[model samples]
Target: MTQGFSPTSTRRGTLAGIAAGAATLAMPRIARAQSEIIRIGFPTPLTGPFAAEAKDQVKSAELAVKQINDKGGVAGRKVELLVRDDKLNAGEAATRTLELIEKDKVHAIVGALSSAVQLAVNEVTRARGVIYVSISQSDTINEVKDFSRFTFHEALNPHMTTAAVAKHTFKKGSKIAYLVADYAYGHEMLRGFKRAQEALGATSVGEILHPFGAADYSTFMPRLRSMRPDILCICNFGRDQANAIKQAVDFGMNRQARIVVPVLLHNQRLAIGPEAFDGVVGGANYYWGLEDTIPSAKAFNDAFKAAHDGAYPTDYGAYGYTGVYSLLLAMQKAGGTETDKVIAALEELKYDVAKGPQHYRKCDHQSVQSVLVLESKKKGEMKNPADLFKVLATEPASEDILRTCKELGFPA
Candidate 1:
């Protein structure tokens, strides 16, 4: 949502090429062995409704590569970040991922914007035994059926995020309704919301499933109003979230029930503005405002700003950086890019990057990290244009917030 960098086609294609080529070509056999090109595949929706978020993701990932290359890269090997536009379609995502791995020979993968798209891309990565650091949210990805030894989830799953949100926002006997996108992401969020509802003794009024990128919420608005829920949870992302919130406000629903988003995006808040987004509560993986109190946040924020004309990174955009940077660190720790060695290294990795200290859970490869409970700021509360969220609480990274390994169908 903030002013961020977008790569031109020419620049995108040539990224890290010269450095990697020179580093490898100039070396003798012994020297060149450690200087081989390490290509990282990045697949995200760059042409659809999620374009804005994808652009941010690309910029942040590029920043990670730039920072790493500046330090001479992993064990003298330069990284060539090969990005592809998945167009937000599962089939297209799979196709692009295959090309990256088979054609481009990328050693690993780091980006996916949507739940379904991530799942599709995961299939390709998993089949090839390539390490995938998913930046998208999905509970199913952590489950045994979809998870593999090489799979690492850098983003918070639906259960972990929603449970924290419910603890903070839900009251005993509260009536809730859901406006879910009709897909894997929405279904997963709905499942988590229901679990939260049961845990908190909150009652569900009704649920309405809408298309992922639906432009109109008119039909669903009237039915939602009839439900008369005390809290309305809109489980969607990107422009869908912005449009739904705007339409809800126009329908005077905001006056009746509190609105909660499962994932609050900085760009979405900017699109909806403070007026429509005001008083909304949601969970965030990272917020640039944390730079004030967190040293790592300050580092990431300063570097991003220095590169992109003083623009702060978006919450989702932080995932892109964390995913790539963490993977590269793991490769460095492993001393090479062998799949098994890298996997072992990632499991043992403890990183403090865009956020606080975090590591992947061995059982499911889910990143153990904090979830910030953020409330949208009112227009009167704005200190600056970018000051949109007021952090209410920081839910510390704990196994308690996450689904247990046993719950994810993992054996003891």
Candidate 2:
């Protein structure tokens, strides 16, 4: 574990700095100065239900850092990363982010796994004028009230992800039900599902809100089974998603309804097993299966596998690489770590890193990228332990799936 930051320790560090300065006075000024390194903060839930996903995120991010440093870094300066565990709590996320900024002096931040935790970290970064690229999904963060010039969302929002999933999964007159997580993430996804259901002439039969870390979903299964909807959308994430789908299948819910996940995670799929997720349709930000078609995908997969003992990157894990790589590339284009210049470069820059071409939208700073429609393969169809999903469709990146800036309360 890294050292925990405290106000008293910060004061002690200051005194220690003075003594070190006195000791280093006889040394060369160039050797004494430590301004040749760039530090970016990475805060994620490294010790909670999302630990598996978080571990993959850190590994990919470390790969990005290593790749950049191998290329002599941006403008000849070495890059450093400051990692902290947020524990999946909003308040804890905010506090750790504060330490990253006030204590460690990170130039930018580029890691978050949960919607609420990202928003909490954003608040701290915004107040301090630090550049933050959120790699988590949340529609509320795009609102004008919550967004800032320094904030950029590299992850797909609920609006874009759910629209793609709903279009392909729902049909006319289909009976739909939602098992929501009762948080910002689940609420936003539920809202998107409702909009799509209405547009497609579908009927909403039932909607149930469960707590974030629900261990057992047997109680909710009865109500969902009674509804008998043709489509059941599981609107939870992380370990909650794994347990929900497992219990739902055990209750014979999938026998009657088509199970759909708005954001299908590779880590969650491995946890739920093939038997539980077979025939499950959902949307994903990135899937290793795309390496067959996209050159960028192949490049990322090859590099990540070489670095991580031949293991592939998960759906959300790719965000960690994309988010940090894009930020450093922007800094290189801007020729410095100046916040305004980096933001400008990011706004105008476009590149294909992992999932084909993508760029940040100017209005809300949301990453405009493709959403992959994936179906979990049956156990009999598996070729390898990592080969899980088959890409059914690729919803090309466009503004059609995104909510208009006007609808997000932005000025016309």
Candidate 3:
């Protein structure tokens, strides 16, 4: 990986309080006629490796609902978000979705961060016929085994995210090695990057997957040193990623190869510091600095800061906000919350989000929006703590990259 490859990097308790409060919520769950509220289920990993980003997502969704309700709600019905903690487990995600749908009577659901959790949630929501709108980047969330007409994704899939950054990587160097986790999302991430490297006439040096939550990457680094690939395409998550990047920095691995962290977030920058992540390229869903490109993006950052003690927006929050915001617009357009009507409206829904104009590609229900390819600014280049990434380009989604349901062997 070249230093200029592309786009693109959690907490714990006090965590539970944030989760519980967001569940009951600040978006007015105030007393109203039962029929006056439109319920959307939000299931997320609130207490694991995924906590920091997932909470940002769920709270931002709450903020969107508050904004919608403040403007007289979706379709004149106040939106009520029903929250559940999936605990980063697939079985837990399934049970949470079931409870949200069958017991809480929510009309739709937004899934958790983990692909395995998302697969479970998709299974439940599809069989039960509740609307599922996701920002989960894993391609298989809507794969043939689990896809349903009721589901729509607002974020780029793993393939799209990887390719967005990979195109830029091809311009930098060849002979790539992958450092990934060992799960569904990781497998998809590896597969996507592999295809990109091969397509760009690059040769893969090797691939290594560290178990989730591995405290030390002591073993992986020396092997990366030995392989001597020009690029290190990382597909690990949470603390695992932070640990890997930190160790790489300490070991001066960047002298050996460039780093590419697919799906970087703001919190990661804070956790590991700029020196550690220096010269890395990342594929990301949103960046706070996008406020410069998209006017309303500034509005979101301003509001998010005011609400959270001057905190900044992450890609997770950006996608979650856009997803909920568009869902509300689709409902309003449909004139009712009836499933078929809303689905029809969403298939053509166009809304200006933090990332300019966004519309759903009907065949696969994936949002056709921009994915940011960014390079991490060096410690000296940083204007402040929040100014982590210097935007390379906000690449537009192309039909060539986003595979359709039919191509993925899903029912049309």
The candidate that achieves the highest lDDT relative to the unseen native structure:
1
302-382: candidate 2 lDDT, tens digit per residue = 999998899999988899999999999998898778788999999997978899999998888989999999999999898
Models 1 onward score TM values of 0.92, 0.91, 0.89
Q: Order of candidates by lDDT, top first?
A: 1, 2, 3
Candidate 1 clashes between residue pairs 3 or more apart in a chain or in different chains: none
Global lDDT scores for all candidate models: 0.87, 0.86, 0.78
Tell me the lDDT of candidate 1: 0.87
Which sections of candidate 3 miss by over 4 Å?
1-34, 171-173, 404-406, 410-412
lDDT of 1 by residue, 129-247 (tens): 57899999999888876766778999999998999888899999999989999998999999998999898999999999998899999889999999999999999989999999999
* 18-39: candidate 3 lDDT, tens digit per residue: 3333344324333435356899
Which whole-number lDDT from 0 to 100 does residue 254 have in model 1?
91
Candidate 1 Cα outliers beyond 4 Å, as residue runs: 1-32
Residue 287, model 1: Cα distance from true site in angstroms: 0.5
Candidate numbers sorted by TM-score from highest down: 1, 2, 3
Itemize residue pairs with steric clashes in candidate 2: none
Off by over 4 Å in 2: 1-35
